[model samples]
Target chain A: MTYDWTLWIVFILIGLATTLPRGSFIILGERASLPEGLQKALRYAPAAALAAIVVPDVVLVGGVVEVLNPKLAAAFAAVLATQVSRNPWLPFIVGMGVLLGLRHFL
Target chain B: MSPSFREGAREGFRVFLPLSVGLIPWALVTGMTMGGVGFTPLQAMGMNVIVFAGTAQLGTLPLIAAGSPVWLIVVTAFVLNLRFIIFSAALARGFHGVPRAERWLAGHLLTDGVFATCLEKMLSHEDPRWRLGYYLAPSLWSWLLWQVFAFCGVMAAGSIPKSWSLEFMATIALIVLLVPMARLRPMLLAALTGGTLAVLLRGMPLRLGVIVAIIGGIAAGFAAERWQGAAR
Candidate 1:
């Protein structure tokens, strides 16, 4: 186990570094304008980051890409819900419902 | 809070409601994972309160468990959270003309979901109040819930059955968030490259793969946009 003091130090360091980047540009205010190209690239940041997170959760099992897990089906259901209803909440509901059912049956 | 700020907070909370469900499972799992690693409740909660980034905290837990040095742990978590720099820059644009103090607060509380919502509202020409309110409210909502669910996870550690598979909700949450953003060709390409690279690099340690994928996706998306512009 990490020493209590060591853990505290680590937490504080992590907190500072994480927040620094998050606040730096915002604090710069009107003094700085990110390049137009960079701003356009930032537009894709959400989609890219979210997909980076989602893919591993659904596709990987024991660090291997496996489609056998229930998450794959749930992902499909969620995507369909998003497409059909155009409601963000529906995908999570439908996905969870499908996951629960699949977990019970699979 | 000022009356307008209060109103903005309320609107932000309301808009974030849907995404909160997705956050619950992840927070619960994070708490439980902390407990599994023999962290005291105080330590666990302390980490959540201070290190507020869920992905970074979670990524670091495994390293801690393995007795990795403090430097390695810090570096890994830092890299994992590098995406927020991009978010902060983008948020600065969305929140242009806001007071410095308010912008500082927004920057501290920023998360990917809130940032995306704010960007969307800004791009659509919503009033400045709506934009600020929308961002602050959801960021607060998710932050509070993160603490609550994390504490719940610690208290109820090992109680949540694996069969519940609540963690999958995180992915589901991302799905809902990512889908709406994928309307554009560049967005789709970004998602494809990011998701594909993440899977391909899944074996990389310290969740470095996520950072790699994010960079790769952005590059692909940026190139795609430039190519389209040239053809036109």
Candidate 2:
């Protein structure tokens, strides 16, 4: 673990993960296909995975659940900004700005 | 390149130029996050050039920092990138009569923005002008912009003090990424359930909570979708 071989191995695994799944259909071409039900499920997986990662990041500080914090407030503002502007850039600007602002003030 | 390729390249660059702006903060943040996790700038850029996925990179770098199992890190990145499979399938079908080599190259280069642009211009258009040139230009430029900015982020993040919560930039980037995807009802349900379960299951070892939460979230979303279908 010391040479950071772990991260490097993870990178290789991730590279395979990236290329293999992406190349599956391209390589399979006209022969193989994913099931329709499975296809539907795939669409939601990223959303779920992202939420799983982010929720704790916001609610938990140093592995303890603490919702009343700058990150959560900033996350909420970002969520609201998304609805108000489809500009894509607005949410980050609003969210990060709020996080820094609140970290300063609160 | 040939005349057609040059034509496609020109159009690709033009269309891609606008979308390229949206990519700047993402690539830079990803690079910064690489550095944020204590990797040397070279290692940071190495991961960038190798993994080449923003979500997967942003998501898993934290796991590496957390000392989670290698398998867990790989699985998380794999799941985060699964959407690419769908993109690959659709991309294969949309652009007909492409050479086999080009298909391989295009698949490797494909990104969400490029996929959307391809669907609009190359896939549906059926124009001979929708040659490889049209697609490759944006794909390569997307790759190039990603590498250049990411490398820059790796270098820049080194200068910024860590107390600035520089890696929080990655979290905020993920937040922005997730917000757009959560637009649909099922998606919102999925995120909500996923987040809740993650909070409850936080005590799990090896960061297994993430996997459990993801599964729980997807199940919740599926149930909601099925329930909605019945209502309709």
Taking chain A of candidate 2, what TM-score results?
0.85
Using TM-score as the measure, which candidate wins? 2
* Clash totals in order: 1, 0
Q: What is the two-chain DockQ of model 2? A: 0.59
Q: Residues A35-65, candidate 1: write the lDDT tens digits.
A: 7766677677667777776787688777788
Q: In candidate 1, which residue pairs clash?
A: B8-B133
DockQ (C-alpha based) per candidate is 0.44, 0.59
Which parts of model 1 are misplaced by more than 4 Å?
A1-14, A86-90, B1-44, B53-106, B111-159, B203-210
Q: Can you write out model 2's per-residue Cα lDDT over B69-134, one digit (the tens) per residue?
A: 888888988898899999888766654666777777777677888878876666565644355788
Worst 10 residues of 1 chain B by lDDT: B162-171
* Collision pairs in model 2: none
